[model samples]
Every structure is written in structure tokens, then in C-alpha cells.
Target chain A: MPSDSHEIVTQVYAAKKDNKAADSFIEAYMPFIRSETAKFTGRQPSQSDDELSIAMFAFYEAIRSYSRFKGAFLKYASVNIKRRLIDNSRRERRKLGVVSLDQPAGDNEGSSVLSEIIEDKGRPYDELEEREAVHQELAELTERLSVLGITLSDAAENSPHQKRTLEACRKAVDFARSEPGIIEDFLRTRRIPLSAIAQATGESRKTLERHRRYLAVVLLIFSGGFETIQEHIIQTLKGGAER
Target chain B: MRYIVAECHPAYAILLDENAELVYAANLHYSVGQTVESPVLMETEKTSGNRSAIMHTVRRAAATAAACLLIFGAYRLYMGSADRSAGSTIFMSANASVCMEINNKGEVISVKALNENGEALLSGYSYKGKDKATVSDELVELSISYGYISSGDTVSFYIDAPESGVYDSYRTELLGRLGSYPINTDIQKYDSSVQVRSDFTVSTQATSAQPETAANSTQSYSSMTETAETPAADTEAVTNSTVSTPADEQQAESAYPYHDPETYTGQSGEGNENWHGSGDHGYWYEESTDEEENESSTSEDTDQPYNRRHDWSDGYGRYGQDDDDEDICQYSEDDCDTSSESSWNSWFTGWSGYRFYSYCEREEVSECGGTDICTYDTGRDSYFSCEHGTECVQPDDTTDETEETEKTENMDETE
Candidate 1:
């Protein structure tokens, strides 16, 4: 039992970094994923089933995100698979009509029905382009964070849990944005000027130091022309303040 | 909360929300850059490790403090109540009876009246902040002022303590205070080791013994007065006449001598036995005979004239006059011996005014000098002169001595 658990943890850690390892890990947990989908749907799901595909995707996501802190990998994967299947079912219910998008164009031979899609004001294409732009912005932010010896996971982990501490971090970010030199200094030194931020914003040095990596990520996103990421953080801060 | 698929993976996709923050979501046949609304997102643990640890420590500390406060509060309540209910108990009985609950520090915790008279005696009295001795002194004074106890009446104290030494100390302190009053007091001790009887009735024996002592002393004084008035009277016949006389006037005279302090020690010592004996007339008579001997010894030590006055005036002269008034006549007898001792002290203490007042009053002399000096002192060049002749003449010395000696012999015979 211990060896099996050790193997599962080892596979999940490997799968987080390697796409092939993640694919193989999903294939190995296919039976477990099917069982979780079966529990949610209350019936056996075939290979072609959409719920089965969603559960498989959820299992793969669990592998990518699994850490020792989250406890037994199988239990975590089972919960993720069940939740994903429920979400998919709910989303499917909200659709007004289901279109295949692969339907044949009646007038043109060898043309799919997707070619006739003009009504919806090109929303899907625009959404797709917007998604690509967001992806570019995120990739840029990820690259900048890596330069500061921080991962996206580390930033998520070190983010302040308490509202007061989060407000203090935001204040320090605001101060850095106001004084461009501080942001330049951070980028040059690759270090958060905790004492200067503490003095300028009246936030304690300890708070800035404790959340130094998260502050660095926010500051870099703001200074490095990552407008998509910056707007996302501003919206989140506004929503938190409203709450 | 819509998300656009930013990057697609075989297992999960990095999706960007409208806010542009990247999130991990399950990929369901999604191509790269495909916009997806309401995607199934990964659930990350909300609380950080450090925050959870701080919360756990804070919870444990709060629980510990609550437990400690509960225990301490319960203990304080228990001890406070324990102090109130624990300690020595004292039952004081004059004509009125009261039971005092005292703490270890000798403070009076409560004073409960045992009967109607006791309730009346303690009415409007506050015992708060007063120690046992002070409370006792005040209670005895109240007993007198309220007429629950007066000249020669007995006040009895029953003390029950956690130890014999405690009982002894209470007995001594109480007796000492009560001795100052012109009344008799008796003390009985009980060790706390013995289970105290729940029934708080003053013992029948103790109650009966006090009156018996008072009656014996009253009877002796009557006999002595009879001997002084009629020198030819038979001693046994005179002793038997005790039951016929009104003893209030003589009892009042007996109370006066208590102004002398020397007699207080002897009276207190005698108070111990007054409650010890069974209420047997024979026992009391024997005790009175002992008192007579002590008196005779005192008379021998003092001057002849003073002895004659003491022997005549301090006897049960008023006992015969107040026969119907048993309260005054009965208890008057207890002070006869003390009166003999007081006569000696009163002379040096210049209590001559009190002596003359008692003398003139008892004799019913209408024109006895200024109501302060008896007409008997007119023959001597003393503190006061009288216009009236010395109506109180000395009885023939030989005859008076013969009568006293005979009375002593008869009392001894009776014993």
C-alpha cells in the first residue's frame, strides 16, 4: 500500500512538469476516473462519453496540481473528477441549443456548417483572439516571475490569506506604481524594497517581507506592460474592497 | 466569472478570466485559444499553512483560559460558603436564649434567637463586623436593659468549638465579660469532636441548676436575716422561714455590692459549679453552707461594726418581704457570698453612699439622713450627719455571735 502511494505521488510530481508524463498518468488512472464519473452520473460511462472525457481531464488536472500538502492523491483526484463532471452537466443544461459545428453546409459541397456561421457577430472568433491575447500576457508574466526566482504556484501559496495583509500588499504596490523609481529599482535589483515600501505606505516591513514574492510578481506585472494581468489584479482588488 | 482558454494541456488548461488572472481548469476537448465560460476550475486549499497554525494555537489558548477561570470561580464560591458555615457555636441563655455561630477568627457569623424572649432581646440588633466577645458583651447588656436578666439572674453560655483549647479560651473570655455585670453567668464546654446535637434546646439540667443555686443563696440570706432580726429565734426555724419572705429588696442590695471588683473573680469561679450540679436541694444547701463558712471567715477579717452591718444588711432580709415575687427573691440568694467580699472592697472604694441607700431602703426608715446616709451612722462622726437619732442600733454582740454560730451549726447539720 505504501509503495503504491509513493508511486502515485512520484507520478503526479513528474506529470506536473512533463506533458508526456501527465498524459501517461491520466491513462494509468483511467479506471479510477471512470469510477468517479460513474459515481456522479450513477451509470457506467463509455470511452466516447463527454462526462468520461471531462473526468479524465479533471484527473489530469489533479495530477498537475497535487502536492504532499493535499493528502492522498487518489482521494483528491476522485473529488476533482466528480466536481468537474457536475460542472459540465450544469453548463450543458444552460445551453439553449446544442449544435454539432461539424454539420454539412447544404449549398456547398465539401464544406462544413461552420463556414456559414455569420450571425453571432463573430463573437466566437473575437473570444478566441481575446483568449490568445490573455494567454500571451500570462506567458509574459510567467517569464518575468521566473526571472525573480518565483513560480506561479509559489506566488499563489505566499499570497496573503487575511484581508488586512492583502490590503497592505496592495498599498505597497500602489506606492511602487506612484513612484516609478521604486519599480525600476525592484526590476534592477530583483528584490522587493521592503523597508522603503514600509516607510512610504506605513505598512510594516515584516508584512512586506513576508509577502515579498507575491509583491514582486504584482510589481513586475504592473511595470512590465502586462495590461491584461494588471487589469485582472485591479478588478480582484476592487471586488475585495467592495466585499 | 467567464474564462478564455489561454493555454491547453492534455490534462488541464491555463485559462484567463475576464480580469485576466490565469487559473487552472479541466480541459474538455478544448483547442488552444478557445473561449470557455463557466469552466470547471481546480479547487486549491483556501487557508495557508502558517495561518492555520496560528488559528490552532489561538483556539487552544482560549480553551485553556476558560477551563482555568471555571475551576477558580467554583473554588472561590466553595471556600466563601465554607468559611460562613464553619467554626465554634455558642448558645447564650439569660431568661432569653440565643445561639451565636462564630468563625475561627472569633467573629460572630450569625446570631439566631432560640425562643421568643431571645428574639425580642436581639430585635433591631446588628451583629455585623463584631467579634464574639464584643457581641457577647453587648448581648448581656441588652439582656439587662431589656429586663430579660437583672440583679442575681443567671446567664448561661454553652460553647462548642473545634478543639478543647478553643472552647476553654471562649469560656474564659465570655465569663470574664459577664462577671462585670450584677448578674450570675454559667459556661458549659463541648468539644467539636463530639457530634453536636441538632436539637438546640438548652439542657434541662443546666436550666434547672441555675435557679437551684439562686434559690439556695436566697434561702441562706433569709436565714441570716432572721438570725439578725430576732436574736432569740431558733437557727433551724430561721433557715426554714426562707420560703415565707419577699426577697426583692435584699436581692437589690445584693446587686449593689457588685460595684466592687474583687468579688467578680469569686462570683465567676462559683458560676462554673452553679450549672454542674443536678437540681438537688441537698446539693445546693451544702454549697450554701460552704458560702457561710467563707462569709464567717470574711467577717473575722473585717472590723466588728462593718461585719455586723454586713451580716445584718447583706442577708435575705428582703427575701421574706417579696415571697410572692419569685424572680427577684429566688435569684437573690446567689449573691450572698459575693456581698460579703464586696463589703470589704466597698469600704475602701468609698461605696458608703450605696451601702446607706440599700440600708435605709431595707429598714424603711423615713427620715434617714439625705437618702444617701443611713440613720445608723448618726452615732459615729463619719462622712454624713443625720438629724434623726440612730434608730439602727447594734444588736448585742454576744447574742448576735451566738445566733450566727448556731445557724452555722444547724446548716452543717442539715448538710
Candidate 2:
């Protein structure tokens, strides 16, 4: 199996050199071409879409010309597909005036060819009901912790209460999030490695060991995935001083 | 992360297969074999088309050139006619029977005589003068002293043609050539008592060179006295009078003979008598009118202190001396008010204003600190222990605030 981009590109070039092999290679990548064209055209492209044809031709051209020095063959092919589709769009725009979506359909009365429907995605409501979002995130966190034989409630119970202790735990969590290898190890093993955290944060091992599960949960929130819950918690921590 | 990355490839494969069905595979395959044409080569091909259109452009250029030449020729003809219209007047003398063309500048363009002798002498000659003439030939200069005279103010040579016969007939033939404009018959003669008098004056001027220097020296002396005793502004006017040439002073003296300088201090009734006694001489007529007006206006001020002294100096030398006492008094009051409030300062500054010292010069001598310094500090500085005293600082703040208030008031007044 090809491991690197260079091996993949070399194989594609070799396949294009043979007429029979080139046909199979182009046919195999045809779905990939249609998907990239759809990404730009904002819908599933059909046989009638000129952008699909342009993207396919660009992919075929890329297979013929791509070299190992250019890095990834898929990336090179995607770039060519995008560029050709844009060029076709510009050409069509000059040749034919843009048809507005609001134009009424002749065959159907009281119906536009393209409807003006707005999709909200409920993002603002998520921020407004921040408590519900945090509770939802905590449920997901409990499920993730269940695999490690630890519950979300146990992590919360172990959380530092005194201001100085909480600050020390936050320093260890921040260190683990910044150092990707530590976070990756924690995620893979479902455990906080106390020695690494203590060495990095200069906190005593016993203190970090005691708060390790809480630090692990905080690290998970900071790293990725839990964006809304993380923002709410940071705001809470900042307001904690007033309390 | 590994699962997400793995899923992207499968998703891409599905997208490509979906789009590949939309593309006409045969068309895509054909296009893949073809190469794109170079943009540089296409540009060169476009330039080749420009060569084929060159002959069509040449015909257009030739047509435009012909039109430009036609317009230029018409403009030249219009300008030529305008020049001819400028110098086209001809005057004919009724009695002399001589016709001549005179351009706007009064130069003789051409001369034609009706009588034989006049015709013979003036056939090729041109005279260019108001009251002077020149007679010459193609070969030699005949006379430099030859002259012509015209009637009234502007000269035109309808008479005084070059020949001896033209000179003899000038009084009789050209007496009425001036047309309804009454001209003295004596002026028609080709003779000159006036010119002789002018020549005598020139000769006398050449002979009396020493008196010119003596008059100039006296003028310089008078200007120095004016600078020392009167305001500096008066010295400029006095210097201008003193610097006049001896001929100018002679003209002044001849125009208005010496009158009692005191007569100018009275009303216009008395002043007009002296002006008329001078016969209102030609150059001084305007000066006499101005003097008459001055006397009438300043008659009321005759009793004012220092008024007679100022008026006496003005009357003694400069014939048309300006009245400067009012300006002197105004400047004196301004200096006293701005620099000091003391009675001593007021009296001394009032006299100093007329003594030919500029405000800046007097300011330097008397230590008059300008608008910036407080007047209260002038005589009181020696009495106070501190150099400027609190009076100086307090008034500066008051003065600045008042200045701002005054500026706003002035802006309001303008609006």
C-alpha cells in the first residue's frame, strides 16, 4: 500500500501512462470530483452542471501532470478542480446574465424557481441557554469518563474548592492543553499522568495527583470539542473572584 | 483524528464519482489530450491584424491633414484684414490741399502734395513727429532741425511740408485746414518765438549750474532740520521736496511767487486771493486749489496750541505741504495710553511724537514696554521690592482675559 503522498502520486502517474489503467483511475476518482464541484456550486451537481465537467477535466489533467515534488496528489487535483470551476463560472457570467433566485417560475404560480428560506441553526439560542449547553456537555463528559471507571460527578467532587488550590489545578490543566503530547496521552489512556503535569507546572505531585481527574476533565474542555461549555466555564472562573 | 482523516478520502471518492457522471466522459477525455494555447502567441496574432488595417488609417490621416490646412489658411486671411483695419485713416487739409495717411500711433504713413513744389519735396519722405519733423532722401540726410507743427493737442502733419514754397504758404493756405476748430493764425507761421524762448531757457540752465548745486544743498539742510525737529513721517515729505531739481524749484517759484505764509492760516476768502494773485500759474493751479481747501478747513484750528508752529513750517518751504499735526497728536495719545498713565509721560510723549522719532525708536529710548507690559509698572517698579511686583502679574492675567473678551466682541460686532 502507498504510505506517503509521493508514492500515491507516482502510482497515479504510472496508471495515467497506460490507457487501460488511466480509464480505471479516472473512473475511481469521479465521485471525488463531483463532491468538490458540489462544494462550490452549493448543491449536488448533475450531468447538466458545467462545473462538474470542468472539475472532472481538471482532475484528469492533474493525474497526467502531477509530480512527487508538488507534495500531495489529492490536494493538487482538488486545487486544479477548484480553479477550472471558477474559470468556467467567470466565463458563463460574462456570456449570460446572472439569473436571480427570486425570479418567478412560469409553469408554477405563486412559486419562485429558488425559495428564500432562512436557516437559523439555533446557534444564538444555544448561547442564550448556556446552562442547558453546559449540562449537555457534562452528560457527554460523563459518558466519556465512564470508560475509565470514573464518573463526571466524581471529577466534580474532586475539584479544588479553595482559590489557591483551584489556581494550581488550572495551571496544570493549561500546561496539559498547550503540550499536545500530554493531552494526546491523556485522551488515549483516559488517565492524567501526574508526574508529567507536576514536572511541567512545578506543582507538587501530591497536589496534582489529588486533582488529576478534575484536571483531566478541564483539559478535555480546553483542547477542542466542548467550545460553548469551555467559554461558559472560563467566564465563571473569571467571575469567581467576585464571589 | 485518524477516523476523521480516513473518512475524508471516502467522502472525496463519493463526490468524484457523483460529478464524473455529470461530465461527458468522451468530452473530458478529448480535452485532456488538448493543450491550452499560450496568451503571448494570441497577442502577437492580434497585432498582425493591425497591419492589415494600416492603408485604411492612411486615407483617414490624409483627409484630416487637408482639413487642418484649410482652417489655417482661412485664419491667416482674417488676421491680415484685422491688421489692415488698424492703420487705415487718411486726413486731408482743406487749405494746404495736402493728403496724408496717419496710423493710430501718429506716424506719417504716406504723404501726397497737391502743389508742384510741395509734391517734389515730400514725394519719398516720411515725417514721424507730433511737433517735430525730419526731411531726408535715399542718399543723404537733408536737415535734422526741420520740424512740423499741428493744430490743437494731438499733432497731424496737414501742413509744414518740406519745400520752401510749402513753408511760405503755411500761414495763408493752412489757416483754416483745422476745420471749425479755431486755431491762432500766429501758430500757423513756420516761425518760432516760443521755441527761441525754450532754447534760451535751456541755455540759461546750462549756464547756471552752480545755483542748482546750491539749491540742492539748501534742500538737504532743510530736510535734516525737518528730520530733527518734526515727526519722521514729515521728513519723508520734506526730503522729497528738498530733493527736487533746481528747474523744478524754479518752476514752482515762477508759478507761485512768495506770499506771506500767515495768509494760509485764514479762511478760504483770504487764501483764494493769494492763489489768484499768483495768476493760478499752469502747473500750480491744482496745488492752489488744494491749499485753498486746506486753509478753509484748518481755519478753526488756528488757535490750537502748537498749531501755528506746525503750520508756519509747512508754509515756509513746501508749497503743497500736507497737514500732519492731527496724526502727530493721535500717535502721541496712543503712545501715552499704551505705555504709561503718568502725567509726565503723557506730556513728554506728546511732544516726542512730533520730533521725528519713530514709535519703535522712542520705545527703545524711554523703556516703553509695549502692549505686553502693564502700564501700572512703569513708575511704580522702583517703589516695589519685587522686580515686576504683584501688580505686573495680576494685570497680565486681566489683560489676557480682556483681550479674549474683546476678540469675541469684535467677532459679534462683525456678524
Encode model 2's per-residue lDDT on B257-345: one tens digit a residue. Answer: 43332354332222532222111110111122333223321211111111111111122232223332222121332433211111111
Q: For model 1 chain A, where is the 10-residue window of minimal lDDT?
A: A154-163
Residue B237 in model 1: lDDT: 34
Query: How much does candidate 1 score in TM-score?
Result: 0.39
DockQ of 2: 0.01
Off by over 4 Å in 1: A1-122, A175-202, A223-225, A231-241, B1-85, B91-155, B162-183, B187-415
Off by over 4 Å in 2: A1-132, A236-243, B1-415
Best by DockQ: 1
By DockQ thresholds, what CAPRI class is model 2? Answer: incorrect
Q: For model 2, what is the error of residue A107's alpha carbon versus the real structure, in angstroms, after optimal superposition?
A: 59
Model 2 has fnat of 0.01
DockQ of 1: 0.11
What is the lDDT, from 0 to 100, of the residue B150 in candidate 1?
85
